[model samples]
Target chain A: MDSYASTRLTRIRTAMKDQGLGGLLVCANGMRRDHVRYVTNLNVLGSWAIAVLGPERGPALFIEDPWDLDRARRDSWAESVTAGPGLLDGIVRAAGELGLRGPVGVAGMELMEAGLVLALRERLAPLTLQPATRLLVELRLLKDEGELRAIRRASELADAGYEVFLGTARAGLPEYELVAEIEGFLRDAGAEDNMMILASGGVEVTGMRPPTSKRLQVGDLVTAELTPQVNGYYAQICRTLVIGEPSAAQQQSFEIFWQAQEAAMESARPGVTISQVAEAQNEVFRKAGFGEYVSKRYTRARGHGLGLHFDDEPLIWEGNDLRLQAGMVLIAHPNTYLPLAGYMVLGDPLVITDGGCERLTKTERRLFAVAP
Target chain B: MKRGLVEWDRQELPEGAFAARLAACRAGMCEERLDALLVYTDVWRAGHVRFLSHYLPYWSSGLLVLPLEGEPLLLSTQPQRVFPWIAETSLLREVRAAPALGKAAAAVLAERGWRRAGVVELQELPWGIYADLTAEAPGACELVDASALMRGVRLSEDGHEEALLTKAAAMAAAPLAALDPVGQRDWAVIATLERAYRRAGAEDLMLLVTSPTAGQWPGVPREAVLADGVLLQASLEYKGHWLQLSRTWLPAGASPLRGLYDRLGRAYAELSETARPGLSEAEAAGLLKRLAPGDGLHLFAAHASGSAPFTPLPGLDGIEEGMVVALHLGAEDRQGHRALVGDTFLARREGLARVTT
Candidate 1:
C-alpha cells in the first residue's frame, strides 16, 4: 500500500481500537462521499457505497451499482470489492465475513437510508451499532501533504474559473450562460467538479444562488462563489464584479466585505477558535454600522472549511468553538447582503500554518470591473 | 452537486405545469387515503419535489409538504435570506427556512391536524430526519411509505416532462456525436463533453469513459491517451429531467471489435424494436437473451429513466406508455474483443421511440 493509505489505515484502526469498536462501516453516496473516499480512495458515484474496515482484516468495499463493480475493484485499495443488485445484502454479508463481533461504528449513520439502518440493526443481532461521524471528521480535520497539494491545484483552478468569469461577464449575457462559460473552462482545465452559485443585480439581490436566467445589465453587481474540486479536494474563491464602471456605493460596499474577510483571515491561526475568526469578521461589519447583517438573517457563515467536501468542518460561524490548528484549510468569506449595494462577496482560501494562515488564492482582493 | 443552470424557465415549465403535477399528486394522496404527502429532497435527489414545486435544491436538504387540500409548502434547509430567491424561482408561495426539516414538517402536520402522512421514499429518508419526524409528531399521526404511490404517479410522463426529456436527450447526445477520441487523452474528451453540456445548460452530468487499453470497465475519465475501441457513457440532467446515451468509437483501421460492434448494433435495434408498451422488464430480458444468446452478451442496465429513483428493469412493473427507458447492452469475446451500445427511448402508444438518436 502507498504511504498515504497506510498512514490513514493506521490512524483509523487506532481510533477504532480506542472506541472499542470491532469494525468501522463508512457509508457514502454521491453527496456524502468524503468518508468512503477517505477510507477506500474511490470516488463514489451512483446511489451509495459502504466500506467495511475491521481491525484484523483489510477493508471491504460494497457499492450499490453493479456496473461500477469493475471500476471499484480497479480503483479502490480495499482487499475485496463487491457491487449489488442487493447492496444491503452484500454489506451485511461482508460485515459478517469480516467477523465484526463487537459494536461497530458507522460514520454516516444519520445519512443512511432509514430502512437500510433498521435492516442492518435487525440482521447484525447483538452487535451494537454506534454513530462515528464525528470520529471521521476529527481524523480528516488536518490536511496532509498529498491533500494539500490537491487543494492547491483546486485553488489554481478556482482562480482560472474566476478569470473566465471576469472575461465572460458582459451586458446582455444571461447569468446561466455566464456560469456555463465558467464551468466549461473549469472542466476543460481538469476540475472534477465545481460547486458554484452566482447572482447578478443591484440592491434587489439578497445573496448568491444557482445561476438564473436573468441577464446582466450595465452597472449590475455579479457575485459568485466558485469552488472547484480536483482529486476530491475543494478550494473556493468568492468575488464580486461589476458589468460596468462601479458606482461609489458599490465600491464602498466592496471595501466593507474586503476588510471583513481580511480580518477573518488574519484571525485564523493555530490556537484560535473558529468563533473568534467569525467574530473578527463580524466586528468589521459592526464597526461599519451593518452589524445586523452578521446574523443568520442576512448570511449563512462568515467562512467555512473546504476539503473533500465543499462544506467541511470548522464552519466560521458564531457558537462554533472548534479551534483552528496547523494544517487545517478553510475559506474566510465575509459574504452577506449590504443594503448599500445589495450583496457582496470577498473571500480567499487559506491554510492555517504553525504561526499564521497563508492565503492559497492569489486573485486580487478587489471588485473587478468589465466594460459594458 | 448540480451547480449548473438551475433556473426555472416558465416558458418551458409554466406555473400551470406545476399546478397540474400538484393536482395529480393530491389526487394520488386522495386515492391512498393520505391526509398529506411529504417528499424529501436533497441535492442528489430533488426530482419529486422539483416536479411538484419547481424547487431544485442547490444544497442541503428540504421537505415538501403537500396537503390533500391546500397548496404545497416547501421547508428548505437553506438560510431564510435565500427564501425570496426560492420563492421567485419555484411555484411554492410558502417557503420556510427550516434547518431541522423533520421538526418543521412535524409542526406543519400538527398545525394541519393531519392524521395520516405518506412519506414518499420513506425508506430513503435520512435516519435523523425520520427519527425526528416520528418523535416530534402528534401521538396519533401515522407515517407510511408512499414510494410506490409516488412512482406510480410519476411513471407516466406529462407533456412538459416529455418535452424536457427530449431536449435533454438531444443535449446529451450532441457532444458525444461531436467527439473525436482518436489520439486524445480521456480527460480532454471529457472536457469536450463537459464544455458542450454546460454550454447547453445541463443541470448535472455523470460521464464515464472506457477503453480496452485503459480498462475494460467504464470509469471516470482520466488522463490516459486514447487509441481505439473507446466507449463513452453520458447521463445528464437538464431542467430537472434526465437522459442517458452510450456510444462506442472505433478507428477506421482494422480492429478485432469491428464485427462485435455490428452485432451489438443489431442487438440494440432488436431490443428497441421489441420495447413496446406493456412489455414487462422480464420479457425485455428474455428477448435480450434470445437476441444475444449464451455468453455472447452482458446486460448492464435496462430501466425507466427521465426522473429520479430510476427503476431498473426486471422490476415489478412493465413498460408503460409515456415512460422513458434506458437500455445498455455489452458484448465481449475470449480474445478480449468487446463492444457496447445503449440509448434512451420513449414508450409511445404505438411503439418505442428512441430519444437519444
Candidate 2:
C-alpha cells in the first residue's frame, strides 16, 4: 500500500476502535460516495458499491455490476473484490465472514433508500447499525500530502478554465458555447468532472445555471462558478467577467466583493472559527449598507470546505462555530447579489496553515473585462 | 458518475406538457384507486418527479406528493434554497420544506384523507423513514407498488419528447464526426466530445472508450495513446430523455475486422427489423440469440431509454409504438476480439427508425 493509503487506514482504524466499532460498512450508490472513494479509491460510476473494512479481515469491495469487478480489482486497495448476480447476498456473506459483531458503523446511509437499509438491518440481525457520517467527515477533514497535491492540481485546472473563459467570453457567442470551451479545456487538461454554473446578461441578471443558448451582448456581465475535479478532488473558483468595459455600478460592486473576499481570506488562520471568516465578509456588506442582501436567498454560503467533495463541511456562514484547524482547505468566496450589478462571483481555494492560510489558486482577483 | 438533480435548461418546459403528464399520472392513480401518488427522487434518479414537474432535486432527497383532487406538493429539506431553482425550472406552484420525509408524507396523507396511496420504488425508500411513515399512518393508509403504473404510462414518447431525443442524439454524435482518434489520448477525446455535447444542450454525457489492446469491454480513459482501432460509447441525457450511441474507429487500411463490423451492423438491422409493436419479450430474446454472435448477460442488446437508460429491462410490455430504445450489440471471440455498436432507435409499427445517425 502507498504511504497515504496506509496512513488513512490507520487513522480510520484508530477512529473505529475509539468508537467501539468492530467493522465499518461503507455504502455508496449514485451520489455522495465520498466515504467509499476516500477509503478505497474506487468509483462505482453509475452503479452501487459497498466496502466492508474490518479490524482483522482488512477491506473487501462489493459491487452490483460485473464490469466493475475488474475495475475494483485493478484500481482498489481492497484485498478481495466480489461481484455477481446476488450482490446483496454477497454483502451479507462478507459481513458474516469478516466476523463483525455488536454495533457496526455505517456511512452514506442518508442516500440509501430506506427499504434497502431496513432489509440489511433485518438480514444482519443482532448487530446494531449506527450512523458514521460524523466519523467519515472527521477523517476526511484534514488534507494529507497526497490529497493536498490532488487539490492543487484541481485548482490549477480551475485556473486553466478561467483562462479559457477570458479567451472565449465575448459578444455574439451563446453562453453555453463558452461553457463548452471552458469545460472542454479543463477536461482536456485531465479534469475528471466539472460543476459549473454560468450566467451572462445585462446588469440585472437573476441567477446562474448550466449555460443556456442565450446569446451574449456587449457589456454583459458573466459570472461563473468553475469547479473542476482532478483525481476525485474538487477545487472551485468563482469569477465575474464583463464582455467589454464594465459600467460604474459593476465596478463598484466588484470592489466591495473583492474587499470582502480579502477580509474573509485574511481571517482564515488556525484556531479561528469558520464563522469569523464569514463575519468578516458579511461585515463588509453590512458596512456598505447592503446587509439585507446577505441572506441565504440572495447568496450561497460565503465559502465551504474543498476536498474529496465539492461542498464539504464547516460551512463558512454567519454564527457557525466550527473552528479552523491547520491542514483544512477552504474556499473564501463572498459571492453575493448586488442590486446594482446583480449576482457577481469571486473567490479562490485556500489551505489553513499554522499561522495563516495559503491560497491554492493563483488566478487574479480583478474584475475581468473581455475586449469586444 | 451519477446523474445530478440540476436543470441544464434555463427555461422550463411548456406548461401544457407538464399538465398533460400530470393528467396521465392522475389517470393512472385513479385507475388503481389511489388517492395520492408519492414519487421519490434523489440526485441519482429524479426522472419521475422531473417528468410530472420540470423541477430537479438537489443535495437532499425529494418527494412529489400529488393528490387526486388538489395541487401537487414538493417536499424538500431546503425549500427556500430550492424555491427559485424550482420556480425557474418547473410549473408546480406549491413547495414545502420537510426534514422528515416519511412523517411529512404521512401528514399529507392524513390531511388529504388518502386511504389508498401508491409509492413508486417503495423498496428503495430508507427503512427509518418507512418505519416513521408506517407508525404515523398506522392503519389509516395502505401503500402499493406504483412502479409498473408509472413505467407503463411513460413507455411511449410524445411528439415533443421524440424531437428532444432526436436533437440530443445529433448533439452527442456531432463530436464524433470531427474526431480523428489518431495520436490522441483518451482523456483528450472525451474532453472534446463532452464539450461539444454540453454546449449543444446535453445535460449529462457519459463516455466509455475501449480498444483491442484493452481486454475489457468498457475501458476507462487515461493518458494512454489511442490505438489504431477503438470503440467509443457516448450516452447523452437532455431534457430528461436519454440518447446513447457507440462508434468504432478504424483506419482505411484495416480489413481484418471488416467481417466483425459487418456482422455487428447486421445484428442491429435484424433487431430493428424484428422489433415490432406487438413482439413478445421471449420472441425478441429468441431472435437475438439466433442472430447475434455474443451473449448478453441481461439482454442489453436492445433496451428502453428515458431519464435513465435500459430501465425496466425489456419485457413484452416494454415494446410499444413511439418507444425510444437503445440498440447496443456486443460480440466477442475466445481470441479476445471484442466489438460493440449501439445507437438510439424509435420503435414503429412498421419496424424501427434510427434517431442518431
Candidate 2 lDDT, B61-174, residue by residue in tens: 678898888799988765364476677667667988787988998888887777899988777766556667777863778988788778766764667677777777777767
Q: Interface-residue RMSD per candidate?
A: 1.8, 3.8
Give the chain A TM-score for each candidate.
0.98, 0.97
lDDT (C-alpha) at residue B45 in model 1: 77
Docking quality (DockQ) of candidate 2: 0.43
lDDT of 2 at A129: 84
Q: Runs in model 1 with CA error above 4 Å?
A: B276-285, B293-296, B302-311, B314-322, B348-351
B1-357, model 1: which lDDT tens digit per residue? 676778778898889987877788878888889999999988877778887787878887899998898778888888888787787778888888888888999999899888999999888888889878988998878989988778777765688888888888878876776778867877778877877787788888877887854546567766677787688888888888877777889887898778778878888788778768776667765787787653367666545442353545543136677677777787776666567788887778777788888
Give, for candidate 1 chain B, the lowest lDDT window spanning 10 residues: B302-311
